[model samples]
Target: MPNAAPEIRTFLCRSDNIGVLIRDPGTGACAAIDVPEAAPVLATLEAEGWRLTDILVTHRHADHIEGIPEVVERTGARVTAPEKARAAVPGAARYIGEGDRVTVGGLEATVWETPGHCADHITYHFGEARIVFSGDTLFTLGCGRVMEAEPATLWRSLVRFLDLPGETAVYSGHDYVLSNARFALAAEPENAALQARAAEAERLAQEGRFLIPSTIGTEKATNPFLRAGEPALARAVDLPEGTDPAQVFTALRAWKNRF
Candidate 1:
């Protein structure tokens, strides 16, 4: 039998950063994806009556890891950080890389080193549950800016996600759906599906609700960055049909930088 699906809660952290809590119903073991801020994380844990057992670090960016020390001091949670970011994340009890498995109670996640926004970035994929915690590397309808690696490197990391089942639920680090929707429309103006999605984004923003956990199928259809191989997206970037997908992806990312 498969493990029981974990209960997930998403709330705002500092500014636009998203804080996520995953609790395994079977053993009551809980984990936080990243500690963007301690107050909100601690409050949420207290309210939910879940004791945090693990802190999964995706990268070493100050905003992402700044609250780790405080949270650890409070909860005594064990931390799992990227091997490359060991020095940056001082409280890490275990440094992991690609192919490593992390468990909380009966829930398990496979660590994937998806470096593009930063060299230490990694994604936690719960394959059996079809859920992924994509920290900064992949967002809702948008990918991260090419900050550390070349655009091609980021493109490669994004491509790896395409291999997952379309129903996979994608939980990203930030809530940038509104901005990403505007750019997606500009990139693929003729896409009816994208037009509908943009309208939905507008409605959600009006109600002060966020668009999170977008499905891989929804992203594949509406995310311009993921559709760089499509002829329409290539044309939007002033590239001819059949251009190398990576080159098209590079052009699309460049356009997004300006958008």
Candidate 2:
């Protein structure tokens, strides 16, 4: 079978976080993921000779947004972001929310409202690419903090992503693998996959490399938050036997927040 031509270049930046630059082969225009700062993102675009076509902001955190002004000024690119983030995220030329689909370069990206890291946080799912830019909601080995939502909201919100295809590649806003791994071990000491993942993450980080782009399958198998209702989680968090599924999930998240 013939290999597919590459359509994007994902740059790991800002303390091992990411700013993905997706290029349109036909127009040479590029779209970037959460651009925390200007110079690095611009440098990557200039180096590749790709023009900026648009910007996609997963959420409105400063670390994820601080660069939009310069990016808009330099590229004359339109910004597409969550409707609720218009105030928090400047230069949002277009607003998107749940069930909205944004098209670029023969690809269609679907929006998902993922409100835990923040109430207005969103996930962009490029189904054809089998990838999702999870902002701060879902991470490699753990979920984001329950800052914007309560235990209940976060619990149900988390279940939404659990239904994604097993092979979907997750790209989070930051690289917290090392810390998240330790937390997972505390919560699910008996999970062999968690132990194995810690070692692999350590090796990758030691080499100054990324341990991301983890598949949904791997997360479902090892991520403690997603396994919130499992026996190990229930026992570790002191939830009584046969608790309600949602309550079990809440207990697990509460414990992890303190973990």
Candidate 3:
């Protein structure tokens, strides 16, 4: 029989980063997406009373993987990371690449190489669950800072997510909705949807609530990074009306870096 969809939980760690957990209800197997710090992850697991069976690393960045050792020690979870990130992350038991698969008990995650933020970054897609662990590639209304990959390469990665089903729920690596929303408005100040979303994000921030778990359909409609090719965004950003989408994307990234 096919496995049941995994249950997802998101929590904050290290101020701005967001950590994720995916648990297969049928098998009672849980996976930790990245361990910025082990304390909160351990605490969360204890609270949920779920035994962690896997650790899924998205990149080699310190904040993303520093807690792997402790979490692994505490949970005895199998560690899986991008091939390049394996050495940096201690206790990693498996290395995955684009098109590779990682099983969290009966739940299967198809990995996609997304190297814009880091050369070894990857995103996980659980098709049956209609969910994606986007890591730092695609954010709520923005994309990751281009640290290694070329601008064009990152653009391609961002575009790839658009092809997924429109309803796919995107759980990005950080809680950057407030800042990204401000930048998004600068890219499309007249967009009503963008305005409303920004207001909601601001309200959520004021209330100290999480502002993530955005949908692909929502991002496609409001995310400035994803809409670089659209005439409205191009015009708002003062780029030529018909500038190449890739160039617009490059400009947007540069602008966000300084914003």
Candidate 4:
């Protein structure tokens, strides 16, 4: 039997990104994932009637951490982000790097410096919950562009993230489920789970719902990027079978950037 009250709860914010708000209902304290803007975060805090105790920023992107200053000013919550992001982020009270851990009430989140989407990107792992705030680093069926790092470097980064426990819930930043699915389908139509997930994503999009915070096991079952080393991915992208996973991985992301 599972403990119903302690399950980490998350929901959509503005229908674009899945900003998770985890609070100990037992204590009424809260923590927010990446805050794209201050208003919606504040609204969520208001609705829960919980005090904003902390903010976790995964990267320094404007869309990810743009609302930091305003929120910090109002709530005075402690802020934690990657060490490299300290220069870019405003109002961060504590800087974190790989292996460091932070706690919000009873829940704990470990920091992993996963830099590829940007030179300073990081992922926050809610250890006990088996959840990670992946930012733009890892998506449901896609990963972020290798803008700040080379394809090889980005490939290594993605591979490292994939090594996490399979059941870990991945809460990414953007809502790319449907578009990623279309591209994944084009890249690997034979993937039955991807096809089914595409249908589900299409339905969710049409219903004005969000499709994010998917599990790593599910991504392994459907996400082409997560399956970069598979022969099916090789065929989908026209790469020679048994090519270096890094190369195949590079090509897959490049194709999606265009798609």
RMSD to true structure for each model, in Å: 0.8, 2.3, 1.2, 2.2
Ranking by lDDT: 1, 3, 2, 4
lDDT of 1 by residue, 116-204 (tens): 89999999999988999999999998999889989889999999999999999999999999999999999999999899988988898
Question: Residue 124 in candidate 3 has what lDDT?
Answer: 93
TM-score of each: 0.98, 0.91, 0.97, 0.93
The residue-by-residue lDDT of candidate 3 on 162-217, one tens digit each, is: 89899999999899998899999988899898999999998888888877899999
- How do the residues 1-259 of candidate 2 rate in per-residue lDDT, one tens digit apiece? 3223336666666765677777657556568888878888899988988888888998888888888898889988889989988889755778999999986666668999988778889988888778788878888897778787787777677788789899988888788889889988988888898899989999998898766778899998899888876877778778876667678777777777676
Q: What stretches of model 2 exceed 4 Å from their correct place?
A: 1-6
Top candidate when judged by lDDT against the true structure: 1
- Choose the strongest candidate by TM-score: 1
Model 4 TM-score, 2 decimals: 0.93
List per-prediction Cα lDDT, in the order shown: 0.93, 0.81, 0.89, 0.81
TM-score of 2: 0.91
Show where candidate 3 strays beyond 4 Å: none
In candidate 2, the residue pairs with backbone N, CA or C atoms under 3 Å apart (3 or more residues apart, or in different chains) clash, namely none
Position 10, candidate 2: lDDT: 62
Q: Please report, as a residue range, the 10-residue window in candidate 3 with the lowest summed lDDT.
A: 84-93
lDDT of 4 by residue, 112-154 (tens): 8888889898888876778788888888888888889887777
